[model samples]
Target: MRCKYPIYLLLSLIVLSCQRKDQVVKRDNEPDIHILQGEDTEMNTAIENAQKSLYKFKEAIESRNPDYYNFALKERFNTAGSGGEHIWISEVQYSDDKFYGIVDGDPISTTEVKLGDTIEINPHNITDWIYIDKNIVKGGYTTRVLRKRMSQKEREQMDKENGFTIENE
Candidate 1:
């Protein structure tokens, strides 16, 4: 237990020491632009959540298999997956980029991605990549595949926005 205390102290110190201290470069005095591409984070949520809420809404209304869903939704389900192959989606247009948006807010974080920007998100892995559409959502991109690689500062920023805890690495 005595040795464990030293290791714990070391970890805590390591976590605290390397906070956000560096800065991005000044490009024409504007913030450095980061092009984020690939994978929708909200899609990682379970299909059943959408099925229960989204499709269910359309299904109940139309009395048929739901291929149509609402344009804005905020569903909380524990599926933790990119909704599988069988899901049909409504397109959310952000200038040109289309993302599978939830019923609540926009899908592609507009503040994050810009049009004509070449960004890469490894949906499956870093080596595996797909070209992000500046105006459309790729249907086959699974939530698991497009793993979000959040930078330290970005993660902290998102955590603050979402009111969640962030672990800095």
Candidate 2:
């Protein structure tokens, strides 16, 4: 009886200490995996707005020949990734119901991101977007001249004032 009790105790301990090894789980109310679409709407709207804002800014810079240069938009996701201040998103585009971004000269087409390799995230993983504008400073150093997130309404107003139409196709 004592031996049986110790075996049961050890088995219980092992089971309690173990965690689910799968990245996804099947539930009665939830799916086996988290699909990117139909999960995040705010992020989708934010990205769309960011795209519009960038388009307007680029057009203005080109037409007016602004001194500012090297402007880009970046996004962060909820997926597991290394902690860093430098966000690596060069571009974001939609293909096959998922958003892909260029990070560090490579395209990220999946949810899991590799270490030191900036990649796009599933739409559901997106947390926020950053609009960055870098300008050449003294000593040939590029400084962040502008960094902020604009709301969809704000972008719309700016577009109207600049005589730009945001045509999403």
Candidate 3:
């Protein structure tokens, strides 16, 4: 039984070591800084690629042809996320008319709507700009919180300097 205990412990350590080695390395060019800090330097390199095929989807509201973002939303989804993640475009039938169609991605996911505010269905509004960024953050794009921590005192001073104030507390 004593020998069995040490053997069991040894097997556990081996399994753990294997898992550590097999961890999916997420980056190719840069050593993911959060995982292996300061191991690789940043590089700015541009790679050219043509856009992906766009699939037309149901538009919730009619905005004419070009104004509808169903094409671009699919394109953004293809570019930003793992392709198999099942992206779909949805047109919000608005009783409160803020936005019409949204790529089923973050930033778009929570942004509010306003009545009579029609989206012209252009690429700028349709693009899931936060999609890649939100996904990469692991804990879902709480970078704003980190920024608050990093800039709290500086921001507070700036607010005071700029005549922005908190009166009571």
Candidate 4:
């Protein structure tokens, strides 16, 4: 029995170590925003133009064509005050004048946020809104699945160079 216990302990340790360290375990309530698989750096970017209306952003998300735009939302301050900016990876969905979406990936918050929870964003205090539209290559097109982080400027530059432009309002 003692020898069996030792073998079992060793097996458990090996199993735990084989698991990916970056795997994010979410709670039961939150929505599932499965942006990427496996370990990779989280996405973050600062939105340069605050004057733009949310309508533009809303339209993009609701269109349901964003198969390659993965992003992370960083917390911010506004009329809502602190703790309002719950940082999480999510894809926004607009319906009935309210933005609804799921947590796409792990969040930077200590609070318990599940993978498929509804996300709320104060239309005004949004920061770090960086993403890329679908990609088109020579003779064919491809979805933007590369887990690389890009700045707002870089994203815009890539858009223009690729002949794909996201309207700004």
Best candidate according to TM-score: 4
Per-candidate TM-scores read: 0.19, 0.26, 0.17, 0.37
For candidate 2, lDDT tens digit of each residue in 1-169?
A: 0112211111110000012221233345321221223223443455455445544443533443434332233444333233211233434444454445554212123344442353444443332333222321111001111101335684454444433222221
Evaluated at residue 65, the lDDT of candidate 1 is 22
Candidate 4 deviant stretches above 4 angstroms: 1-45, 48-53, 62-86, 108-114, 136-169
Model 3 clashing residue pairs (backbone):
97-114, 97-115, 98-114
Which model, 3 or 4, shows the larger lDDT? Answer: 4
The parts of candidate 3 lying over 4 Å away from their true place are 1-52, 55-72, 75-88, 92-100, 108-119, 124-169
Candidate 3, residues 1-169: lDDT per residue as tens digits? 0111211111111000111222223344321111111111110000001111111222313334332221212112222222211122333332343334443322221233222233434342232211111112111111122223335785464344333222222
TM for candidate 1 is: 0.19
lDDT of each: 0.24, 0.30, 0.23, 0.34
Question: Candidate 3: TM-score?
Answer: 0.17
Which candidate number has the best lDDT? 4
Positional deviation of residue 22's Cα in model 4 after best superposition, in angstroms: 20
In the order shown, the candidates' Cα RMSDs to the true structure are 18.3, 21.3, 22.6, 16.3
Worst 10 residues of 1 by lDDT: 8-17
At residue 144, candidate 1 shows an lDDT of 20
